[model samples]
Target: MLWRAISEELPGPKWAGLFAEYWPFYRKWWLKEGEPARPTYAECRRALKAHMPDLIPLYEDLCDQAGGGDLAARFLSFYCPPPYLSGCSQAVWGGKEPVMVRNYDYNTNAFDSLVLHTGWKGRRVMGTSDGLFGLVDGVNDAGLSISLTFGGRRVVGVGFGVPLILRYVLQTCETAEQAGEILARVPTHMSYNVTVLDRKRKYLTALMAPDRPAIITKAAVATNHQENVEWISHARFTATVERERYLLQRLRFHRDPEEKFINTFLKPPLYSHQFNAGFGTLYTAVYRPRKREMEHRWPGTVWHQKLDAFEEGSRNVLMPGIVA
Candidate 1:
């Protein structure tokens, strides 16, 4: 079902090829385990099968189109991991739903918001069917807010994959606690830190791994590295720590209407800070789900750019209701 959706909506052969390439990397990390017999790939697959069986055929179709050899190579490249860092900011405002903004900058330019939607059952089962789907940062009709950062060094074997996790969080969970419970129970393949905010704007939680979870009593923030977790230290994040600090400071001092906050500050024309290293900011985005009915503002609105094209220091003010 998920692959079918991709075949129906995306450019066929190219998308299928991409999916095949990434599948082995995904399977290797999630299925093969070492010391701690964490979550098994079989278990994760079963969970999706039981919860979202409709997507299996879709993935199979995509794999068949991609062939086997090319798919294997892509998997190897993905699992190797790269030394890159990404920084972003998200904000929620208006109505019961949450809005969001993010800056995705990396050494190698390979980012894409493949698709967007409002369903989870179809997605949870499909996993990373083709490319990433839905809003990497978004709010559901239920008014919950969610966003992510690659675990980088900390990511171990894969459990519930990132794309699937995002889809499940948006589709099934309604509050930060519920989202945390899902994160806590699942055996994760990679090391990722997810921040989930609820509708009332009263509660916020940051789930760092399968075992550690923390509550954010005040305004919350997350960078590429884990926060409040002991196994890692802030020092290890030296490469991108400044970027994270600048974002936190900006959010702390940010003063303006929600739209203005996103447009004037978050959207860019960013001032160079001492902490910034490597290619500044690739692209900045502000998404107010409630304000724009879950549509992404900026690049989607102004330049009609693909997410992979985002570069450091790129800035644009997006109009309302535009989508790729």
Candidate 2:
């Protein structure tokens, strides 16, 4: 259970090589014994091509470069699975550059692959995926930063996963309005809350789901559920209520500089180690899109990188585990 920092350019062999190395291990976790991941891949591929045609070529190139019969299937897993992540995200702008903080919470044993990918075609994305094709939380070179929180639910449908949709936004969008347009158009497999920050010091939180259309709001925090929708996963959704309150509390009343508010995510409520097993906070990310920079902080260390000149290297951070 560790996080790795990796970087590569697309249409290059190095990026494909990285994909080959982790695809096997990630495939094992994404498609367990007697799972329906294959069918999910089919739906995912179709949806990707239909909504985001730009991805089809990139995906095909990745598979061809990897030279694996199941490469596409492996790649699709990152974008087709059930929405099984929990976390907190908030965008703050108070007479300064916007700062977006996100803490990714997911199963430590379940595809625990975390990577901060830089020097990509258009954006620098960091996520718990095998490669740089998708994003869990990332900031683009165009000064648009985004983070996702699972909209607590169980209903799975035919739609693009939120991460891939985020990928789409980073690839083609540069403003909060454009990012919101993309988030609104793409249907998600389940539900997600995407918090976006732009260079213009504008911020927005979009609640997206397959059952309903995307909803935009001016709220600073993007948690698992919203005020209008009744979440399917009641128990998990119940927990989000407090986390949402905690994030909004910081945004509204905590009158401080950007770093101070961002640091709050590294503490309780926003950060947690799952005692019951499954998902937990992998790491906390703070992105300053205007600076074209991002900081990833774990327990004791922090890694900083810029979108234009990212340090190409890999460092491992120990993983979290459960106790009896």
Candidate 3:
């Protein structure tokens, strides 16, 4: 798989090029159930204005850059987009430095595999990009970092996608407390567990769902599911319960060093190689909110990015179990 680190201060030719490259696949997925199945552009715009008014200008900018098309505008809104799911495990390491480590497990074919560094609307944000503008996991200049995991449930409802919610949080909020407010306020189309860590070492996990009010917890680790395992089949398939138990034990019982703690995610129970099953560990990310730095790690290789001096580059990763 190919991964890229792109630096663009704003939405411009670089972003437009990305749109042109990924639009075909996105358009097909957006219309998978036919155009009538999705909401109208009006509803999408309304939701964006209601929940994330601060991002409207940026959204419009990206929409125009995407050829000013109606479908592109609606897609960029990230409001009530088609329901998608991924297997992930994230946690806040409350050791010496405030760090957030996570393994993003998802279909390699469906993933963006892009790390975008942007200073848009005066906020410097860097992280894995999703849906063109949305973020899967990222850190802002304000010393706040966030990541998400699928809440093991099958319910899908009316709300914005969680990636956009993460993007909105990093764009506007500076602390975990502020992020909790937005996470609780924003309605999510599907259930997800979003964990936020600030430079001050404060962290919280918000269990958000469309059908229920968001539940805020001071939990350090978040695997799939919320509170309890609601989706038995999914839980078993993703080993959510096992993974959660393993992480909880590590955090509560074992006093592991910083490097040891981060390294655990690259091994069993966390690192996964079931690519043929559509959910493999694409990459493990470690974020140091206080330092404003992040690392993308595979088995042995690592790519680093820092807010102070960001670099644009690319790497070709050989997927596990694939003969090169």
Q: What are the lDDT scores of the predictions, listed in order?
A: 0.43, 0.69, 0.93
- On lDDT, the stronger of 1 and 2 is 2
94-184, model 3: which lDDT tens digit per residue?
8889799999999887888999999999999999999879999999999999999999899999999999999999999999999999999
Off by over 4 Å in 3: 322-324
**Candidate 2, residues 24-62: lDDT per residue as tens digits?**
775665566435554555665676777887767666766
Off by over 4 Å in 1: 1-85, 91-98, 118-130, 133-135, 151-158, 210-219, 228-241, 251-254, 264-282, 291-324
Per-residue CA lDDT of candidate 1, range 1-324, in tens?
Answer: 011122223326555565555555544543355313433334434555654454445434433455544333233222222222344443334323454555444322234423333233332211112234323555555556576655444544434445455556666677777777665654445556566666555445344443343333233555555553343443344333554565566556654456555554333333112123432343444543323233334333432222212211223343222222
What shift in Å separates residue 57 of candidate 3 from its native position after superposition? 0.6
Best by TM-score: 3
Going through the candidates in the order shown, the clash numbers are 16, 4, 1
Q: How high is each candidate's TM-score?
A: 0.56, 0.86, 0.99
- Per-prediction CA RMSD (Å): 8.8, 3.0, 1.0
